[model samples]
Target: MDLPDPQFSEFVTAFLKDRGLPVEDLQFHSLPSDGSKRLFWRLSPQSDTSFVAMENTPTDDFSKRENVAYLMIGRHLFQKDLPVPEIHHFDLANGWFILDDFGDASLQESALPKERRISLYESAIEILFRIQTEGVEGFNTEWCCQTERYDQYVMQRYEANYFRDAFLHKYLGLKKDWPELENPFNHLAATASRADNQFFLHRDFQSRNIMVSAGKIGILDWQGGRLGPLAYDLASLLIDPYTGLSSSERDEIYQHYLRFLNKYDPRQVEPFRKYFPYLAVQRNLQILGAFSFLSKMRGKTFFEDYISPALKSLRHLLEDLKDPQLSPLKEAVHS
Candidate 1:
């Protein structure tokens, strides 16, 4: 057990005391491998005997919003008899708190044969089905209204000399029209605005954020829960860069989600499948740009391993689109 920030642990002890959880000698455990944000653990010899600690970044960061959204959705889901970690205690002032240790079971840790991936994912989808079917409060239009709101800015940022002139043109010796790429972006954004089926979207809802233990799937890292098109979560799951499922497995899960949707709201089928692939295309590009930008500017070069797969997925998806505007950009990327 290690306390990277002593103040946080001190606060944890006091916070647990206030919550009426047993607290004598709280021992902090070091998980050591938190990506994107720093997280730690402190186990108090309390009633539950364990708690996970997380540090909050600035409010502007999407992670912070996700934290808020997770609690909101967790409350709703818990009330509806869903399997979710209980929030032991939280500190809104300094943005540090303790939570239930759902155990050391991750989807990554349990590697069954590829044939079983679909069954596992479908089980996870059932959680989504529960939330979407049962009306959850605290997540509304405001959560999704700003989803593509960052598209134009992201497109413009990459449109500038930042991406093309700096890396693609200079390093990779690739040259192309920056403005032309924006055409698909514009089309996608327009389509996104008109296609509004809002649900409580777990933005990073994938295997990494999902924990499997005690014969149940526990969702974590849901701080970015927002009211977005259900397609967002669906794409994030089916098209996840990690735990990459084969084409057949992905299709299996897709059909499973479709059946779940049909049972709950059959009207979503035509729109879901149609827009899902498009959303996958759009998401892959943004993820590519984001990984590139992070490596290039933010000194997070560890994302290098992710670029090739993202681009490959982008190419695969864009090739499937018949849109003339998208075809050229796809060619430019692959060429």
Candidate 2:
């Protein structure tokens, strides 16, 4: 068995001991890691409810920022009565924290039937809408670890350029063809920039990050939260390739969200609709880049399986929109 670091285990042990919780026969079990550098472990004890611990040892500049964001944004959300885990103890310099454990089942692993699944998605949407609206209050842009706002620069560099460099050139062997995408990529970024970006955004609000704990939705991987277009996160959820929600099923769920959006502001709905597809395409592009990089370069092969389906989704979306500015992007995915 891969044992936890003695110091970290001691950290958890002492932290629990101070809270009057027994730590007898304590054991640490390592959990599977995702694309990010953060590490997770399940801390089990003799009888108390188990808690999870996080290790955010930074390997680079971005990861260093990720650690801070996880703490600041995480505490901020917990204070807002959001569904995030309760942070118990943290050692920022040492990069470890203990939290309430929601268990191993993700929304991706949710085994409900179609109708019940949609119902669960409805709950997810409700929580997300609250996160979007209420999360803006007391949210400091300074607390953001990534780009403070989802702007054109973020679209170009992280989404479009990432797609070309990582997914196309690196993964698909289209090295020479990237130059052709410059113009349309610029256009797409500019178009997506028109969406309102003041709303709180969870940059990766997909099924895998959602936890369905005993029938309630609990969100994780929230360190990437930032001020972004309202459409982007919703688009990420609806088009998540892992869940493989059908076109009609997505439509049904989308309508459910529209009702909520309408309740928030009737005028915002039309504008949200106008810019949603562009934002969705931007999200899909980022997805391709991220998945390819994680799968091929980082050796996390789990994401490799979703690339084809994501591309197919992008192609279908473009074909339906028939937008001229994105034609080059469609062509790139086609090749």
Candidate 3:
């Protein structure tokens, strides 16, 4: 029960008091930090009753937007009966909130057998479909933290440029311009931007963000979600470097998602599959970039461990796509 500094403790005490809860008996334990600047603490009041406190330390306007987006999107999803944490209390002015504790059983930490993993992934896919469809009915772009849409600009700037700067330059220290890559990135951005089925895209739909507790899957860290190609999130999940899913497993999960889409919206099946690989390439590159940035710039060295897996995933995607434009990227990655 190592408490935070006195000021942080006082803040939490006052916050709990406002909600008619006594903090004198509560025990607070700091949780491990993620890539984001937010700090998390799990506060336990009883054997079974606990809450997770989140404190957002916004260094600039961008992080501030993320703070607000988390609260707004979280409330919206909870109201829609989505499997997100229930917001207990939030104060936007000070950037702190308490939420229902989903426990520490993230999909990344799950050590389930093959059968259980398949079943859990099936449920996750179903929930993803609902978020893409039902979750978009009343979704407003104004609630998005940064980019309103996962358009070409986002692909070029955030995904491609991020890979170029963070992974290629900063991490790998690759100086070669690799002029051949420009055309591939351009083609990918163009094709991905024109994807037909635009829906709510969970920008970081990886294993770590999916929490599994009591046989139910709960989504977390959705502050960066926005309107984007349906394949973006699907790609993010299946090609997640952390999960290390085999080709067969990835195929099974992808087919499952297709079956669900066909049952609900058959019209989207073809286009979704057509754009999935391209989006996967984009997602993998973004993951590599993010892992590298988090490791080098943010000093979270654990992310460095995932860089090789991310590169491998990217190489596989490029090879499977077999697009001539991607040849240069393939060569560079292989090199």
Clash totals for all candidate models: 4, 0, 0
- Candidate 3, residue 209: Cα displacement in angstroms equals 0.6
For model 1, residues 1-335, the per-residue Cα lDDT tens digits are 54557777677768777777766656677774435555666575665466777666446656555556555556666666766777766765556656777777776554356655666777888887766555345445343322523233533353323444544554355665566766766775556534444566565676677888765788776555555567767777777676767788878888888888888778888887777776676566556665666676667777667778766777778777776767656766787
**lDDT rank order:** 2, 3, 1
Ranking by TM-score: 2, 3, 1
For model 2 the TM-score comes to 0.97
TM-score of each prediction: 0.81, 0.97, 0.95
Badly placed stretches (over 4 Å) of model 1 are: 16-25, 32-35, 42-48, 57-70, 135-177, 296-302
Candidate 3, residues 229-253, lDDT tens digits: the string is: 8899989999888878889998999
**Model 1 steric clash pairs:** 66-223, 66-224, 67-223, 144-227
Please identify which of the two predictions, 1 or 3, would achieve the higher TM-score against the true structure.
Answer: 3
Provide the lDDT at 263 for model 3: 94
Higher-lDDT candidate among 1 and 3?
3
C-alpha positional error of residue 265 in candidate 2 after TM-score superposition, expressed in Å? 0.8
| Best prediction by lDDT | 2
| Candidate 2 per-residue lDDT over residues 1-335, each given as its tens digit | 55667888888889989887778777788887788766888887655578999888776777778888898999999999999999989987778889989889888889346656888898999999999999998899887888999999999999998888899889888774567788988888888899899999999999999999889999998899899989999999988998999999789888999999999999999999999988999999999999999999999999999999999988988888789877877877777
Q: Which of the two candidates, 1 or 2, achieves a greater lDDT against the reference?
A: 2
